[model samples]
Target chain A: MDSMMMGAMSKDMMSMPGMEMMDMSIMQACMDACSACEQACTVCSTQMMSCAPACMNCADMCNTMMRAMMRMQGMTPAAMMAMLDACIAMCQVAMDECMEHADHSEVCKMCAQACQACMDACMSMKNTMMSMS
Target chain B: MDSMMMGAMSKDMMSMPGMEMMDMSIMQACMDACSACEQACTVCSTQMMSCAPACMNCADMCNTMMRAMMRMQGMTPAAMMAMLDACIAMCQVAMDECMEHADHSEVCKMCAQACQACMDACMSMKNTMMSMS
Candidate 1:
């Protein structure tokens, strides 16, 4: 997300209870990770391997998670937590599936790494939300 | 999604456990609804209303849901159920937000209707899955 858009999103979020104190840096990192993972998974899905379906699913989930963070007005802490959990689970599944083909395909290897990073970022966001509550 | 792609996806999904009995028509309807909802929400998000964030989130979720259905090889019944639940919840939130502005904005009114249709289609899919199980 760009600085101007972030500024706009932040301003919008300021009105939401429990959202005023959010760390923009953490959210930015998570969104970046999600975007990266989504791209990686989309590329990996083109390989048509057994892992392709999982990669496609992960890509979609990551994009959704990223957008949800950007659209905080549509979410409550509970909804955010649930979405994070779902994203994490989807990433884990994608990573595991991709790892099975990692040795045979470079794309799977890179996709798995992206999924790992996204899972970690989402977990961090979840932790931040937990502490705030 | 085109017929050729659907054919390919159908062939791939035939190998999944417990998916051989799946109804393609129901899945197709759900995917179509998701795609329509995603388009509507994306357009609504650009309107810069208070509902914009929710529309963005809903758009992402709908796209994800549609892709997941297309790539059924990556999904288990449990994962699909979870995803559908999340998508439905996001759509409901988006619809609620858009409904608040429906009287003022034709875009919001259309977006709300799209969300409602998407939600109903997803619920129908869930029902079909439950019956199959």
Candidate 2:
């Protein structure tokens, strides 16, 4: 995220109850990861494999998960936890499918790595949320 | 969704664990609703209101929720519940924001209505899940 965007985000964050202490840098990293994973998964899903649906699903989940982080005030800890689990589960499914064709497809390989990274980032956020409570 | 897409979905649904009994028609309706709401929210977000971020987040969440339903095998019940909660929360945020602009913007009015309907649909799914459990 750019400085201008961060400024806009920070302005919003200040008004969110219990979110005053959030570290914007960490949130930015998570959003960037989610955006990259969504792009990778979208390109990979057009490959016409049996894994296409899973790829599509993963792409959507990553996009959603990223946006949810952006609108943190709307979230409860329970909702955040659930979203992380869904993102992880979807990423796992996508990674499994992409791995089957990883030998022949570069996109699938990149997508699998993206999914892994997204899953990790979500896990980090989930851990943070758990610890905060 | 069209018939061909529905056919593809049904074929895939059969392979998902514990999803053999899913009614495709209901699933199709939900997917269509999600897709429409995503589109509406996306357009609404471009209006540059204070609600733009929330609208954008809601749009992404609805897309993800729709896609997850399409890839049922990628989900566990816990993950599904989490996603539903996130979707509902996002929709609620978007609706509240959009309602503030509803009197002035037709797009916001439609988007708010879409958000409400999406929330209702997700709640229906959550209720179904709770009943099944």
Per model, the share of native interface contacts recovered reads: 0.57, 0.44
Per-residue accuracy of model 2 over A15-131 as CA lDDT, tens digit each: 787667666776777788889988998999888886787788888888778778877765655656767787887788888889998999998999999989888887887776666
lDDT of 1 at A111: 96
Give a tens-digit lDDT track for model 1, residues B1-133: 6878788878878777898888888898899999999999999999999998888888888988998888777877877887888888888889999999999999999999999999999999999899999
Compared with the true structure, all predictions reach lDDT values of: 0.88, 0.80
Report the Cα lDDT for residue A90, model 1: 88
Q: Residue A121's C-alpha lDDT in candidate 2? A: 81
User: How do the residues A32-61 of candidate 1 rate in per-residue lDDT, one tens digit apiece?
Assistant: 999999999999999989988898899889
In model 1 chain A, the worst 10-residue window by lDDT is: A70-79
Per-candidate clashes come to 0, 1
Please, what are the lDDT tens digits per residue for candidate 2 over residues B9-127? 79987677766666667667677778888999999978888888777877888888887887776566666777777778778888988899899999999999998888888887877
